[model samples]
Target: MRHGKQTPEPHEHGGDEGGVLVRGARRYEWSAAVGMLGRRRQVYDGLVALSGVRPGDRVLDIGCGTGYLTRRVARAVGPGGTVVGIDPSPSVIGYAATRAPANCTFQVAGAQALPHADAAFDAVVSSLAIHHLPADDRVTALREMRRVLRPGGRLLVADFSARPRHLRLVNLFGGMTRHARQHHPMADLADLVGRAGFAPTGSGDRWPSLHYVQARRPLEDVSAGAEASRP
Candidate 1:
């Protein structure tokens, strides 16, 4: 998520100084919850495969909580490649950096304002992260992802589908539809990716509630795309 000043906090409705209180005023660590999500290796593997990462490629993992997916990508890219994991949480970034390989790096940064040059990455990927963003930040984040990608660079976004099958019970009983509604349906995600100047290639479900959309920037007019990112 962007974690921008314009967007409301996830627990803005009610929470102590620490984090969100989901049930009976139970305090939950937001970063810890996200870190646990990183251990869903099945979804991570599926997303990495869909991303088409290759040896010697340069990749950026947005909202890369704890670097689970980032390490997988680094292995795929091999020693010749470089993988950078960026997240808004400094604690997670610090933890990720400790375990990261020489070829991999972690940074504390938001997706909406990436600290990278235009056309810097061969592939840009995010998993289970975008849904946390507010509506406007989602667009800006998508555009920012496109801005950093090389011409014809691949884009892979993996998140829960709007009507998630796995979390159906939670959605119904826990009054979690508010969260579910934040997730984009397949069509909406495709449209957003397209509007961000990426050509939609395809999309598919990976594991329950986990789906991915694949896209790429056009090869022609790479320079124009770079110029457009300038202030």
Candidate 2:
């Protein structure tokens, strides 16, 4: 989630500040109380639809936690396709690896320093996790997403656009949603994606708990031509 502002006080997940809530909220016992709100399903289904994932395509899931969505994407992409799920947290990444399918792989890495070749993937996606970074890191991560995506590849990022409460609930419920700081930086996200060479053509549904932003990379720079304009 590219929240427009770059410097959030860093909503700590699993009780670690100065760090993007590394472990998702599910790490806590109370997460189930919060999850029944249908947030997970909304996010899971939304990303699947936004990515338009098909068989035989390479997909990258950044900040993947518990491999919940990663496993699903792996199945959707099928045999010929490959799915790579990356996250910086060892605890969560370890959990993700156990669920890895034959076509899916897991890695422990940071969004700003992705360990992949340029133009190596067909799609790059993240869910409910981007807001934990400082604004500058947010931009760097977007560029990394594009650098790893093949030309014409798609990107789907979903974040918490709004929360009923801010910092208080963030430390309390950060497991269920890392970017739970109540405030959203959607505008900054738009700018970061634009600068990272993406064209954001759609805004996802805004519910009381979440908001999503979707964009795609162009086949060519068309930096100064009408041929590049999106309808």
Candidate 3:
């Protein structure tokens, strides 16, 4: 990874809520903070597995702060696959780009307004990002995710949950952390996914402090006969 290099300044993006931005040294500090939570590698790897991404799948990572999970996903996708990560802060995008693998790319964008075309990705994943969005934009972001995914594509959204009050207390220690706490429960997430036209497949909590919802875009009906056959 490149180091001691000057990075670009932060830029604005289109979204209902601008959300929190972690820039410059704060990015490194946030990385260190997440590490303190313990089992950082394993936790992130579990998210990649839960995403159900194949070797050649195209993946999109929304609100990919510092590209930590993006890099992990790059490994899962291998050399053939590509992972594009978007965040509103250009500084973090620059930071992530410097450390990005060949198969990974970073962009300045927002969760509610992705820059990709329709059905552009095979899998879409976001971690600890849903809470960062405004309450009004959360469902819009989920719909945007669904719009970018191909038919039958998988989606994994992991974020802090309402349970585990101690973890919420930990977030109060820092301004950045404060905004990262649970804004909604897993049921809310399921509701948003369903509203976005995705079929919910699973939901659960992981070790440490994370709740994830797995879903998929419904496949298009190939024919009227096929549609009628379904009970």
lDDT of 2 at 93: 67
lDDT of 1 by residue, 69-159 (tens): 8998998999999999987765556556878998899887878778899889999998767766665666667888888898889999887
lDDT of model 2 at position 14? 15
| Top lDDT model | 3
What lDDT would candidate 3 get against the real structure? Answer: 0.74
The count of residue-pair clashes in candidate 1 stands at 0
Q: After superposition, which runs of candidate 2 have C-alpha atoms over 4 Å from their true positions?
A: 1-17, 22-33, 36-39, 164-187, 206-208, 221-231
**lDDT, model 2, position 95:** 57
Tens digits of lDDT, candidate 2, 143-224: 7787777767888877665544534454564444433432354545666678777878776654445566677777774331
- What lDDT tens digits, residue by residue, belong to model 3 across residues 1-231? 334655534422223346544335454446445533766788899999999998989999988878889999999999999999998876667777888999999998988767788888999999877766777787778878887888888999987665555556666566555333433354477777777678899999886557889998889712322222233
Q: How many backbone clashes does candidate 2 have?
A: 10
lDDT against the true structure, per candidate, is 0.69, 0.65, 0.74
Candidate that would win on TM-score: 3
Q: Please give the range of 10 consecutive residues that has the lowest summed lDDT in model 2.
A: 222-231
Kindly indicate the candidate among 1 and 3 with the higher TM-score. 3
TM-score, prediction 2: 0.75
Which portions of model 3 miss their true places by more than 4 Å? Answer: 1-18, 21-36, 163-187, 221-231
Where does model 1 exceed 4 Å of error?
Answer: 1-39, 163-187, 223-231
